[model samples]
Target: MAKGGIKFKDSAAAYERLAADVAARRFAPVYLLMGEESYFIDALCDRLAATILDESQRAFGQITVYGRDTEAGQVINLCRQMPMSGDRQVVIVKEAQQMRGLDKLSLYTQQPSPTTVLVLCHKEKSADKRSAFYKGAAAHGAVLESVRPRDYEIAGWLAEHLRRQGLAADGKALSMLTDHLGTDLSKIANELRKLLVSLPEGTKRITDADIEANIGISKDFNNFELCKAVLARDMERSLRIAAHFARNPKDNPLLLTVMALFGQFRQLFLLNYLRWQSRHKGLPFPPDGELMRILRLNNPYALGELKQAAGEWPNRKVFAILGLLREYDAKSKGLNAGGMSDGELLRELLLKIFLL
Candidate 1:
């Protein structure tokens, strides 16, 4: 699967590499942090902002300016100033993309301050590649461009994040968090921090229980159960779960719910397609090993429910369900949707799912 951020081998590798540099006290002359993934960009910038210069030196040696508040000229002048407290100084530019005439940074990069570590944090999107500022940052120092991790990639990221905090998570817990949090690393990291702090001391492994208790995600009524409920063709059970989600809209958003269903249906479609191929070719059914790889399943039992669902639902029906999911997903985002509430939309969608 596709992993790392843009230009890196794995999604987390870019962040880890830069973090290691920060930990090693290896400061670059100019750092350009650009990414759709704000988490790593912010994390890396925060580490540099907090470290690099000591508290005493920060009074005169550090300056943080926002792109909306400051221009390239002002930042350049600040960066060129000599440190008053010590030999090293730090100049951090947050939301750098919002800075007017940001390409003017190329002028400063040509003659960067010897005693300063200048960091430009471009959040939400990357800076223009053809711009001189990007080129100059590359010529002068380091640039970290992070792409958003996919849902599958987030599991590995969450594991590493927990490992650094002296914690681990179970397979089920991993699925719950990834589905709930999706690809937003900052949100996931924030929730995890809150979760970790609230846990009793000496807790080493995170389980579905920990998530349910601390994070308030009901392991019994979450999207996993919703998927299971639908697979079993239990309309009553499915509606009950939908009611639970409606009660806790803060925890179970409609978009996330729609996304979870899409993922489940996609997996079912693949399984049904495989089965169809086996039948047509007069070959033996594909084994669990191949199914595990195709489904990206971590455990054997995860397949049991999916296998059952695939058998019950034909490939054509599953394909149509995927289309229906996309339509509802758009409606959830207010595309061609009237004043229908999320609950209304979801209730209608579930009824249609059963009809299909």
Candidate 2:
């Protein structure tokens, strides 16, 4: 789960199941869509709003409210009433996290009307589990926790997102998309929507060329190549890419570069450990598929770069490089840099890493 420090367990599977149910028009009495991942909350809430009411019914049957402007009693009162001109009523409460005295709404849970679909969208954090409303909502309907997917799980999540759009990304395209866009699902989805609008009709498979031309992330001078160059100890190529980044700071942020390098070194560090375990401890190496999953990789052949990089640096050196990454990550955030530019800081960090 990517909702770091949140106590709730990963809710990705529940999200999928609930989405399927909502798509099939399986309406629950009361839904508490609360979690750190607001993207999931918004997507599901929008789906419910779009699917639950017909165009003619929205004027009278579909009602929307915000937390700041209303109270729990008002919401409950709305839920208690019968639909104006339809059999079913859909009440969507957006940003319910800001609403005070939400627990007071629990009074209605005991006799929740079967004709009302009350959706409470509490996002960016989990709700108070001890609240009567939380317990009542869970017992009466659903408390969907929209947990964010971790770094390793994001690719799969993105793939599923694309699959739902009736599109797919080739392996290279997927890597480029994830690496360039990072794990912000809303941004990724927005980009995909825009890219789809720009592409020729009948285009289903997003290719590297499409990403490069449409998204403007270079297939050549991206952080992916820079990480590969650093891992392979190609100082010349690393410096060259760093220069390109220096020239185009908007396109190549140093912070993202640091993150990419950190991810690469993390994989290399783990690969080094596995290799040592196999050679010294007489443990069998993980199969290619298992190793791929560990690294969150799409291509089996990509293992060659990781294995080769592991051999190029010792464990201690990888640790030192990781330390460099952390230091630069901070420097990129203006922590202790004596006025060095982001590009300059990145260049210095790479040099220090390679020297390790």
Candidate 3:
């Protein structure tokens, strides 16, 4: 069958597939790329323009519009246009979530032009499958893919992506970039691009020292180092990093770091349980790669460490730890009497994690 739906683990794979499909001129009547991850969506759309449409056709037939600026009537008009010296014309509606006449466009979609390709890019969420537009698109054989990248996978991908750019970052540098950027690819790419432009040609190795020097983050004090300190159970380093965050809450917000730390611990606990029971029963913990894919966990020692740590805790302690994080989250947002600096609060939280 020529029509099918597939999801990739991350943006790189998504782009690779999109390029291949577009190269083969296997364009679908309707293509829906929806996700919080914008990099792949942008790249896929760009690929369609650069490769699928010839220069002369693009001048007259390829139309790129934004939801906030363009109306649905214009989109429908473009869709109805005859291709100029090309097999098909492309209509890309970005931020399609903001399009005013999406309901109107649905009527035209019932019998779309075979010589036209419509791509709707909605970054926040998917168009409701029950809606007329979604239904019409699918009934006419559309290609739909969701581009959500897991947090852990981002770190791993960053390293590989950097290598492709002829730049190399060690594990610590990659980890630091993830911590500093907070899992946003656009921002990360922007920052990395800035770094590369300023670097000498043929520069390959990027270290923690170079990052701190260039990015203005303290080498000894950052989210990655703090997370490592907590994971390693080095309370002193954790407290020191907390103190730094407390002093400069604007730079290293306490809420984000706390959330990241707790997320890591929660993943460890889950994997811990999975390892213990799955091994004894001789059954796959995740039954497949489902849990691994979802968690984005890759460390060799991760399962073993989690098993050891989980064995030391009772169920009540796990619940209590979660409760503590919830309380802190609320208090941090000014729900309670939250006067203390993030560093002091994080220090207390690190102590709690260590105790657990």
Candidate 4:
């Protein structure tokens, strides 16, 4: 468990520790949940709400209040109240970031009631580190910073989430979800839940077909497949995928496609530079772990393809393709593109990438 000023590699790790503590019925005097990601914070709050008190105990002990309706001084007074019929009282302040005089809570936090569990749900923002309230909470209780996962980390997190549900997904299916859904954890979890429910009781595995059937993500013509085709330099497949995307412009926006291509080519350029440095400058090629970290690639399977593509596309070609991708990205955004439809722009971009 980390103390103050913590940076988790992913949200799941932070959730795991909190879940374990809550499950064990071990809690601190105060919990300050603050960060950009609300999914984990919301999950922890939900779990705490449901688990900390039973139906009978909740009626007497659990008090849920909103920050806008209550003051920091009122919260302290409530915390001072004794549990009617339980050992401890749980006072949850939702959206505590909006509470006026939040800093004044430091007065009570400094000598908090050992019999009260104060949960402050400060979503999407951090408390002032120098404030008395923040320092007091850090010294007396736990401070969980719920940061969102980066784009690359989503696939691995989704895979692990599926495994916990007794469901399995392949790399392609995982990539399809990641690419289509992006980094919105709440939406991804909801969709996966729907997919899980759609499966028959005995069904254990989720495939690209399952995703397509359940979530409307195409198995063959999606952005994941398009990127794979481009990385392999398969002119025929790349053009075909681009044409499919052109036909379904709503699903495959030209800007997103161009951005994906730009990222792939950028990775290749970096890999080329690193390889050059290793060859002539006596620097060793980074180990697999280091390479993945440097490349910001969470999918090892995709990393393999990227490494192969780097070898196939020379540094000079990668540079040129990057420039072309940048131009197309701007054009797709309607910067200087005169009247080109998304389809025509996509087709033109594919031609340039294939030729390069």
Against the true structure, whose TM-score is highest?
A: 2
lDDT of 2 by residue, 1-356 (tens): 33334422346667778889988989899888998777778888888898888899999898899999999899989998998987999899999988878778889765689999999999887887787778888899987887765655666777777888899887677777777777777888889888899989998888888999999988888887888788779999999999999999988888888888888888888888988999999999999899998886766667877876687888899999988889888988899989999889988988888777
Taken over the whole model, the C-alpha lDDT of each candidate is: 0.84, 0.83, 0.73, 0.85
lDDT of 3 by residue, 1-356 (tens): 01133444534675666668888988878777666667777777777778767786788778889998988888888888888766788888999988887767787678788898888887776676678877787787454455555566677778778766767776667767777777678888888878777766777898888778777667788877786676666788888888888888888877778666667667766766667677787877673346655556544344444445556554466667777888787767766736876666777777886787
Better of 2 and 3 by TM-score: 2
Q: Give the C-alpha lDDT of model 2.
A: 0.83
Indicate which candidate wins on lDDT: 4
lDDT of 3: 0.73
Residue-level lDDT tens digits of model 4 in 45-97: 88888888887899889999999999999999999998887799999999999
Off by over 4 Å in 1: 1-11, 278-293, 297-300, 335-339
Q: For candidate 2, which ten residues in a row score worst on lDDT?
A: 1-10
Model 3: lowest-lDDT 10 consecutive positions: 1-10
TM-score of each: 0.89, 0.94, 0.76, 0.88
Model 3 alpha-carbon drift over 4 Å, by segment: 1-15, 23-26, 54-57, 68-71, 83-88, 139-142, 157-169, 198-206, 267-296, 301-319, 351-356
Residue 340 CA error for candidate 3 (Å)?
Answer: 2.8
